[model samples]
Target chain A: NAGVTQTPKFRVLKTGQSMTLLCAQDMNHEYMYWYRQDPGMGLRLIHYSVGEGTTAKGEVPDGYNVSRLKKQNFLLGLESAAPSQTSVYFCASRRWREDTDTQYFGPGTRLTVL
Target chain B: LAKTTQPISMDSYEGQEVNITCSHNNIATNDYITWYQQFPSQGPRFIIQGYKTKVTNEVASLFIPADRKSSTLSLPRVSLSDTAVYYCLVGDPRITGGGNKLTFGTGTQLKVEL
Candidate 1:
């Protein structure tokens, strides 16, 4: 099974341009998260969803938005891309079982905002 | 939300055992400690996790002290492939709210050389 897969492994964007990152998980996980990893910094959560049709703000949700219309898909959208948004984006998913808390991450999408 | 602190970097030789410790002074009562490994240009991968005492898996072992203030990730017989940034995360997964959203800090970069 493709645990988690992200679309557009790499992309280049200009200021004010908008784009949406697609994240799909085949593991039927109940929780999905979107994060950005900057150099010399840890991965910071931008947004997350506990289940389908539910989304919430994360630690760094100022410049990002997310939607989880389907159980297997979570999308992160940038309304107005800025240079500060240039970083690697990761999508992770995990089951809702209380016994396990392991999250499976996708390869990551490298975004360059010029 | 609990914050984690770990070494910025560590160096070890191949075939040697490596232990990376993380301190979460304000960890909550129901918080769990988890570790993730990340290679260059890739997403972070779950390694091990535990609440208290010890937990072992195929890849590594997680040791949480009785006080629950700190935890250690032990890697046995490290190899070149083991060179990556290791992250420590603390969160409670049972809460359907924001409790499960993991907050990552600057991880420990482990360099395994021959």
Candidate 2:
């Protein structure tokens, strides 16, 4: 399995510009999450989905939106990119099993907003 | 969600054992401790996890004290390849019911020298 894959490994955007990052997982996980990592800081969750068509806000959900239209895909959209949004975005997913909480992460997409 | 505290950085020589500790003094009863390793320009990968006592995996070991307030991640026989940022996270295992989401704090950066 390819596990988790992210599209557009690198991106650059000007202020107010919008873009979407796509994440796909082959593991058929029931939970998917979007997180952003800033320099010298650990990752903060932006949004997450417990299953297809269900989404919820996380610790740092402002300025970002997410959709889980399909069971295997999660999308993160930046409505108006800001300089503060320049960071590495990671996508992760895991199974719904009660015994395990292990999440598999994608390689990450580096975004630079000017 | 419980907040975690860990060292900002650590240095060790190859072939030596490395231990990174994380403190989560406000951890809840159902919270579990997990560790992840991230290399430069890549997404974080799972290392080990435990609710109490100890858990050993091929990559590392996780030890949770009796009080579950702090946990340690132990890496055996480190090499240059083992140099990376290590993250300790504490959260509830049930994502579908979601009370406390998984959170990552500024991880411990380990630099291994030859």
Candidate 3:
């Protein structure tokens, strides 16, 4: 299985431009998440989904939006890209369990907003 | 969501055992410790996890102290492929207020040299 796959391995955007990053998981997981990583900074959650058609705000949800229209897919969109949003974005999914939060992550998409 | 602290970097020789420790002094009662490995330009992957004492899997071993204030990830017979950043995370399993969402630390970079 392709565990998790993210589209646009690399992207460059001008400030205020809009873009979307797609994440797909083959594990049929119930939870999907979006996170961003910057140099010397830990990955922070931007948004997440509990299941298809359900989305929630994470720790760092500013300037980002997400949708889980399909069970196997989650989408992250940047309505107005900012320089602060230039970072590596990762997608992850996991089985729903009250005591288990083991997540499987995607390859990651590197985005640069100038 | 408790904060996690880990080493910045570590070096080891191939075939040697490598241990990366993480500290979470303010961990919650319902929190679990999880470790993830990330190669350059790739997303992080789950390595191991434990709630107490010891937990072993084919890939690695997770050791948690009785206090649960800190945890360690031990890699047996390290190889060049095992060289990567290791992140320790502590999170609540219940989907309450984004605590279940992962909060990554600036991982410890483990380098296995010949």
Please tell me which predicted candidate would have the highest TM-score against the true structure.
Answer: 1
CA lDDT of each candidate?
0.92, 0.91, 0.90
Of candidates 3 and 2, the better by DockQ: 2
Runs in model 1 lying further than 4 Å from the true structure:
none
Chain A superposition TM-score per model: 0.97, 0.96, 0.95
Candidate order by TM-score, highest to lowest?
Answer: 1, 2, 3
Estimate, for each residue in A1-114, the C-alpha lDDT of model 2 and write its tens digit: 999999989999999999999999999888899999998989988999888999999999999999999999999999999999999999999754565578999999999999
Per-residue CA lDDT of candidate 3, range B1-114, in tens?
A: 798889999999999999898999999997889998998888888888789999999999999999999999999999999989999998877754453787887889999999
| Backbone clashes under 3 angstroms, per model | 0, 0, 0
What pairs collide in candidate 2? Answer: none
Best by lDDT: 1
State residue A63's C-alpha deviation in candidate 3, in Å.
1.1
Q: Candidate 2 regions off by >4 Å?
A: A96-98
User: How should the candidates be ordered by DockQ, best one leading?
Assistant: 1, 2, 3
| lDDT score at residue B84, model 1, on the 0-100 scale | 96
| Candidate 1 interface RMSD (Å) | 1.3
DockQ of candidate 3 (2 decimals): 0.68
